[model samples]
Target: MENQTKVTEFILVGFPSHPGSQLLLSVLSSTMYAVTVIGNACMIFIIRTDSKLHTPMYFFLENLSILDICYSSVITPKAALTFSLGKRIISYNDCASQMFFFSLFGTTEAFFLAVMAYDRFTAVCNPLLYKIIMNKRLCVFMVVGSYLSGCINCTIQTGFTFSLSFCGSKEINHFFCDVPAVMYTSCSDTLVNEIVMLALCGSIIVGTALVVFISYGYIIITIVRMPSAESRLKAFSTCSSHMLSVCLFFGTVFFMYAQPGATSSPNKSKAISILYTIVIPMLNPFIYTLRNKEVKESLKKKFKKKGVFFVPLLRMRMTTVSN
Candidate 1:
């Protein structure tokens, strides 16, 4: 970590890498990583190509898919490779780079979720001014602001992390170069580091969460006042995906990072890490798209344009009609 540090590399000793489990873990991790990448990539592509999805909500969603792709990539490929690498060793520089990118994308994503909530609020509570308030320029600015905030967050955390002195070779028990796992290996006293970690993780996770809560509150009130049940259902449907996404994402993240000095067994920590890092990324696309009719329609249109699904069905129906 520092000039006094003897360790030039760290071993990722997260999951059991025994022969039998190694094959299974490698295959499973690789599969999940592939799915996560493809899913998020498709999400971004769909949002980009679909004129119907060019609104602020999907615009923010496009950023989210990008973030999901990035952060998951920061960890997943290395992790899957770990099963095959004889020593599962990662050099100091690589580890640090992983940590920085992971933190940057992860933090930016939390802020973006809050941004999405605010977008939802404005669109729901003040439909008339939604266009004016959430114009493209402001949307781009907010996205850039979130990215800058993430850069600042990760730079500070990564700087403080690798600055500590390590007396010997280290094994990072968790899958990735997560802050806590790296900090845990430092021989130097990390009280300040721990406090700093807690503060930053809390503010990012909880702070964005607070924004989501307030925005949703106002959104709910507005929805409750709507005269038509159909409108109410439509509004609720629009929000349901975001709500589920927020819960699935933030719940595991808060438990994992928000506790600064808390101790957990490596297995438990690994399980939680897998949930947020791998599983959630794979799930988010489905979570967001399954409940959104517009995205579904767009996807169907894409398939139809490609002559994949709907067009074939249309041909079968026309054939029946000819008979």
Candidate 2:
């Protein structure tokens, strides 16, 4: 199909063309985007300034929070702009770049969550050995490792996706430059590309999900076997947030990637996209930090010392709910 005419650009029809609904969605997403940035930024600031928050858990927490910021920034702004301007055309190179960073941040977030799961396993399984296992050097290595994995996967996926020649309809039915959605616009046979996608993206999703599930599974067992009710409850509470976050992140990811080019309606894909790209990032800080008492206390103390009069997006909501 080398002789087939190729598409140099794709027009994204992000949301439905209904004026009222488009207006409502743009407003809602803009508000969510603002909240996502503020929440994640607050966590980053709190983790950075607080000496008490300088542990491995909080260190990973900081990385996660920042990832949320970057992750949301990737798709939300462009999405909002697309809705507002009513111009959703993206150049091939620009689309490739957007998909690259989106995948990069997204994959990094998944691995980071897995790393956090491992950290929790250490904290719960061997509290004493946690220090030894999760030291500064190891933490640094983990962060670096996650970033590297993300970059490699992003490069592979983006390279392959962009290499495919687009010979069919130039209209992309989704809000953002998702790999599968873009692949559907290609007139070239994407059999090899599809296999590469399964090997790289599919493996990451399945492998990471397995690791996280196993980690939490072991954690639940350990928590149940604990002698003290208080200890068990606290451990369970801590794991709940991470577990919920994992489900939200991976559920949408699996749904989108597992079925490549299955967009019956662009609106449905936009709705699904909201779960992982927008909503999950906005919720991650709340899951990882706001639910933890230590993080709250640190934030409160820092706010008091700085005399900062910022509205509490999320106050210390540390309830001792049993697992």
- The best candidate by TM-score is 1
lDDT by residue for model 1 (94-156), tens = 999999999999899899989999999999999999999999999999999999999999999
Cα lDDT listed for each candidate = 0.87, 0.84
lDDT of 1: 0.87
lDDT of model 2 at residue 140? 96
**Please, what's the RMSD in Å of model 1?**
3.7
Cα displacement (angstroms), candidate 1, residue 258, comes to: 1.3
- Candidate 2, residues 214-300, lDDT tens digits: the string is 988889999999999999989987788888899998898887775555434456766889889888888887786757878878877
TM-score versus the correct structure, for each prediction? 0.92, 0.90
Model 1, 234: alpha-carbon shift in Å? 0.6
